[model samples]
Target: MKLALFLVLLTLSMSTRAVLDDCTCLVDCKCKKSLRPGQYYCASPDVDTDSQAIRNCNRDTGTVEVPCYAAPNVSCGGLPYNATQCIFTESRPCTFVNGKRYNYYLAVGLSLFLGMLGVDRFYLGYPAIGLMKLCTMGFFLIGHLLDFLLILLQVVGPADQTGYYAPFYGPLVSRVLVNGTDPFIESSSSCTL
Candidate 1:
């Protein structure tokens, strides 16, 4: 029984390869010799080398679906990105698609204006330290000076729904410096693969 099963599997494998070899592309897109019919594969116009073969391919009157590997760095908001171009900057700033960049002018103005009183820190959700700064005049003397330095460097901001840094100064600065870009657009219509 075991020998029969093994023979059958081997025959099936050989037959599958033969079918793949005979497969032809009906579309005019870039073609790769390694690609077999009923199997999926990626063809890049820019690159000369062929990528890994896809497991399967299926098409219908409405749409042609193939398990094409997603381009790298491409992401759909929080979803995993495939392949997309990304830019990096030194002062990482938060940016959404459609060219919506977060503003830091208000924080800078507030910090410079009331930083001595830790008002900026409070605005950044550090109420505990803000209170301390308010009471002791930013801890006066050495403490005050250090705290002032920290505020000058702009080390504060909003929290997300989870109460974590929704938009913090450090991350913002880093993103700006890196100048990263995500090609995977986030759209209501483009949900779910």
Candidate 2:
């Protein structure tokens, strides 16, 4: 019975005399000196903020106050953080794709002079439609009128190899002299006999 009592007392004394070697157990970690926004702090509580002005008054911890943020006191700039706000900035979901440029003059000329021949359709890139139109002569000219309206509205866009309109160019009369292709082939060539 006496030995049991002595061990209990001995344990209590050892715990009370334990070493407090580092600053870890040190409370009231208020900044000794003022620190700028980006500078580093060496002591237990590394960063100081305007919010920390009142010091640690955490009711749960009584008089001990802990720094609001972690060790690094990087420059986050003043109120209303623009950097974080930029993360939710405007987004352009739909983009306008400029299609291949089809020579406007050449396409228009083909539609006007040889609409029934489907030359315009051929120029724009629809070989099958051009052939059908050529064989039937634009359904006795009714389809020709429709094509003219479609062309004006940009519905009959120049075809790319992918068959999509992308940045079509209207043929400049001056550029014709520069590139120089066979007039007959350009004007009247047909995929079929």
Give the root-mean-square deviation of each candidate in angstroms.
18.4, 30.5
lDDT winner: 2
**What does the lDDT read for residue 27 in candidate 2?**
19
Stretches off by above 4 angstroms in model 1 are 1-103, 141-154, 161-172, 175-193
Report the C-alpha lDDT of model 2 over 83-133, residue by residue, as the tens digit. Answer: 111111111111122234355656777888888999899888899989989
Count clashing residue pairs in model 1. Answer: 33
Kindly provide the TM-score of model 1 when superposed on the true structure, using C-alpha atoms: 0.31
Residue 43 lDDT in model 1? Answer: 28
Kindly list the per-residue Cα lDDT of model 1 for residues 1-193, writing each as its tens digit.
6576455544544443434333332332232223343223232211112211122211111111222221233322233422221111011112221112223455455566676687756766578887888888767745556655554454443422111122332323322222344233222222233
Minimum summed lDDT over a 10-residue window in model 1 is located at: 84-93
Q: lDDT scores for all predictions?
A: 0.37, 0.43
